[model samples]
Target chain A: MSENRVPEEIQENAAHEAAKLGIGTDEWVAQHEERTARKKGLKGVPQFIDESIPAWARWVVLLAAAFAFGAFVDNQYLLRIGVNLGLFVMLSYGLNIVMGYAGLLDLGYVAFYGIGAYGYALMSSEQLGHHWSTWLSVLIIIIGTALLGYIVSLPARRLFGDYLAIVTLFFGQVFVQLVLASDNITFPWADDYVDITAGANGIPGIDPFSFFGHKFLNIRDYYWLLLVLVALLTITISRINRTRIGRAWRTIREDALAAESMGVMVNRLKTMAFVTGAAIAGLAGAIFAAMQSAVFVSGFDMPLMTMIYAAVILGGSGSLAGAVMGAIVMSVLPEVLRVTNYSEILFLAVLVLTLAAVGKSVKRFTINIVSIALIGFAVKILLGFASIKITPTEEWVVGPVSRALSHWMYVPLDRVLWGNCAFVILIVLIAYFTTTTPRIKTILLPIIGYLGIFLWEVRLVTDVNTTRQLLIGAMLVVLMITRPQGFLGKPRVEVL
Target chain B: MSEKKPLLEISNIDTYYGVIHILQQVNLRVDEGELVCLLGGNACGKSTTLKTILGMVKPKVGKIMFAGEDVTHQNTPARVKLGMAVVPENRRLFGPMTVLENLKIGAYVRGEAAQEDLERVYDLFPKLKERSSQLAGTLSGGEQQMVAVGRALMSHPRLILMDEPSMGLAPKLVEQSFEMIANLHSQGVSMLIVEQNANMALSVADRGYVLQTGRIVLEGEAKELAGHEELRRAYLGR
Candidate 1:
């Protein structure tokens, strides 16, 4: 039937039928709108985009901009970096829902990301013997991820915060190990399950995406696709935040007992945030799968988790803008560092020192002067030495020029001196910054108040050689010392 | 008002938090439109009994019959739906929510009665309407108490449970709250109140129960309880 031929009574009937079935009118309208939009071949129909331009035209304009910029850069390599940044933005926004808004710590968020990538890979790759459309796989990826999120949260959510984070992290590790150890569960084309994941070797022959019979092989097209997804994700999260359910989530975050007292279904809202966050991660993962069209164990490793957590923290934890900005920084900074040819250890040292020098109590100009001087000093020392030799890995080399410069660089004494200087500068910066900034001082003040309070925590994690132990330990100490609630968390007082 | 059944009946209710038994064998009853106070000193089982009745704490034993329904094991939200509301001790307002939002949430289970009951609440507390958009936490103690009382009134409950309405208030505000309570009692809203201020509670209540530890020590007409030598000496500082 034509759209016009559908009678008003019939439409009204469709809307009201759910009410007749004992559902609330408001809930009925929401569900009916969702169903009707799906049947009518419209996506986000009720959603308002700018009236001046159709959404499709806006997307075209964005795609054109990305392509033009990519071409101007004169490097497919830089274009690839842009694409990776776009994907991280998507993941970070998704993570923001759990960590930022809902205030749940999900350590193994990458499990859903992995599920999406693998789901798309299995369906669309040549290894599967037949290719499913990327769009179809994307849909499947969302469903798979949402289901996984819901299931994982069912048991995991019984525990709160640190306990939940550990469980999720364990879940991710177990999932990865299962794929590595088992062969029968994987497709027949793979010699082993480990081979599909490539345990270490990684999977190849992953096909580029073709959605709605249109192929988008280049980074430029992927950037456009991801930008649109990111926009939609933002809209979804913003709407949820404003909705009654979102208000419920915030109430639960503030005080679970109080929220329960106020007649909110606290457990339900917590579950929703976890599942929704996971689902969004899955969506990003599907796009990621299509972007790379390849798989490997290292692709979804511990570093991915670190980057996500860093993004959440660096951005204002509960703020939407914070999460988005955090993701963008986390994604782009590594590439920027790669281009600049800076050492990760050196970068970390500088960051820590910079953070210290800019402490809350310090004058603003002092922070600026100290930060600029430190940067200048590091650059001068590196340029002056010009003859040190050290090699970690190709990724860690910082840049091609840095690798070349390292050949003639100093070996023992100079290297030690540089390291020591950086350390000393970092300590000075920390001391200066802490004394200056009350926020930084507040963080350290707790530890000062109870000297060596975290010594037991440090000793407990000494067994785990992984960098994760340090990250977890530092996060715990920082959280406990600075603001027990969180860095930017709101202080909530109990009524009785 | 009804000879057939009391508006609320509490029979031998015991409440515990872990191993600490807070309320033991607590019994109270309110006939339709009757104003009653569960009176006690600090650390007494009055608040615990009120919480038990509101389903904030489930009774370890005994049934809570509200409007002839067994609400012994029902949750707070469920109890709220059955025309039961509480003005909890210490003015348990949603700090971030605007005063209006706090009132709106109180009527969450009110369903269709929201608009009418909201109007009634506004009429009852004009100060709330004036500062409806203000965050409840920012309000002064008396104003917060007004929000708390207005929120309970929005439910248009058959039985309103109040726990220490006069606590932490200045003398003038405490008198004002008690005066408001008297007005609400006269408006035919049956209520079960718990209070440290025995004289004020007894002055308004038609009947009163004196609880010590977890058990009711005295039960009588409000006038009789008000003049009792033991009660006056112990609680009223007479």
Candidate 2:
């Protein structure tokens, strides 16, 4: 008490609070220690970063790193990934404005992006026979998108939460439907049909941005362009957040009714947030259009929107830095998954991470890891009695990592049925284990790990896209379960 | 000011939650530089009456006069600008934001002058100043209550509305909170505090209103209300 170290009282009270929450004394203590240590660790690093490195220096470091990556990665496929990642960064920033700052879930945000794409495509495409300059086209697209956003927000902003979500989702569907149906339209008054939207095949031959007679032809150019734009948007958005408007938006998100009482014009500000997010999305769409030199409705569908949402949510909605990290993860995950070696390493790393996080103590963690090793031997011995054919490592091994895995893994030529069954069983076992006693969980974990590996080798390994999708879906689920605030996001305390 | 008119005058207001008629003909008032407590049990529309004054819950029938202006139809922020501030039920501080940020938002409608108000709040609650950087949600119950009250004060309102300031606090902390409320009243800040703890409310209040089942059953000076036999059985547990 004399030293004024306040944790003594708080720690005592935390025990009582934990008991009320139904957590055991030991578990609560451990969690508290971890939380306190994490806070201490975070405090030091952020202080060091802020004090030692100026904001400009940090940006310089980031830009330098981005450029170095661009210069080093020579493969066109890798460059394409860079561009995609940059685009994802932009999209996440756009979505962050509405979802993070305003706390409005605009499911039809993709439509704004689509509007930007089509707006640019129409003015600068061969189909339209009007090749506008890059500056004019982008300006028109942004303004048009902002206008569309303002219009959409007129009705949607008044709708609260779920209702707003539904309206925006319907708007997305409408955009898709209108574009899909607009191939050949018969006017009510006129006889002849007009080819307006170019329909399902999409409007092609869109001109790339030629800035001052300097054309952006290569994937690297688009990648650089997007990176620069992302940097610019990040600065702009952060500045906006520092203003009274930003504080007002956050207040609205915290409690709309409370914010109103605090003298904030809730509805109008929400509308403004929508328009702002829309403008950014539109800019990203314009760049996307120019990069691809084509406009397809397929690129602006639900999955793309989901990917963007996942990035924003994963990074921590209100944090720009979190958004960037999340965007890069969401973008590069599929590309990494495309390669067997990268995906295998990632899966094993993640599994190890999960084990370390959940294991509680070092002794327990060691036991869990050891149990996994023992499970492999036990399964192998059991398989011998069953007379199942275990293929030689030579046949299935693709990379050095898999070659090493071959010694332990149960690889078989005709194992798809068993593999799929193992995957389902693994899920069930994990679920069941959670509900069971600790002893049961400890005993079943090894089997669960083996089953997971079996599923990975047999089913997930053979398919890249599906594996990527599974990993992302799992990532989202894990995020929701473990930490909804996402990486770099502050843990939110939801007040009732 | 202007012959000592009531700072907040809620005249026979009937507030409803979609025909539920949560508050019926509920009349309450707080004169300048006075502390008034509205005491009631659960769902007795004490909070509804406060919300009605704050413009969160519109009255189906009545007049709410603030500084002699009819503010029944005015919006929440407009009322706030006209010097109305609330420490909401459950101390609804912006959970993710720092205590400083929350306090800043309390003076949000005040704009540039908020810094001075913030200093004033800090002066009242030194603990808030010490833990200014800590998130509002992470604070202990007493600390959160302090932040909530401090936030309301940041608006530098002519009249402050408090909703259940002592609900989750320990007995000692509740006493401390009431003392702070009393301290504020002494400093010429008019307040309308709604609470279920009739005993605590009465101890600090200059005037008190007793509400039950959406109606004001009694109203008098604090000393009279404290001695009311019915209030003793129902609330003070005499």
Which candidate number has the best TM-score?
A: 2
Model 1, CA-based lDDT? 0.67
DockQ of 1: 0.09
Give the clashing residue pairs of candidate 2, or none: none
- How big is the positional error of residue B137 in model 1, measured in Å on the Cα after superposition? 3.2
Worst 10 residues of 1 chain A by lDDT: A449-458
Model 2's CAPRI class? acceptable
Candidate 1 wrong stretches, greater than 4 Å: A1-82, A126-130, A156-158, A183-200, A298-302, A341-413, A421-496, B1-5, B110-123, B126-134, B154-156
Models 1 onward score TM values of 0.71, 0.89
Report the error of model 1 at residue B37, Å. 2.2
Residue lDDT tens for model 1, A387-423:
5443333422344533553433222333334444544
List residue ranges in candidate 2 displaced over 4 A: A1-34, A39-60, A71-74, A155-158, A352-395, A479-482, A494-496, B227-235
What are the per-residue Cα lDDT tens digits for candidate 2 across A1-496? Answer: 1122458688689668766744322343235435544333323453344346775776788789899988898899888888888888888888898989989889999998888888888888876688999999898888888888998888765787888899999999999989889878999999998777898888889888889899988888888788778888888989988777888888888888877877777888898999988998898888888888888898889999999998988888888887888898899987888888898888878777777767767888799889898888777778867888776667667677677877777776676777788888988998898899988888887677777777887778777788889988987897777766776677777553
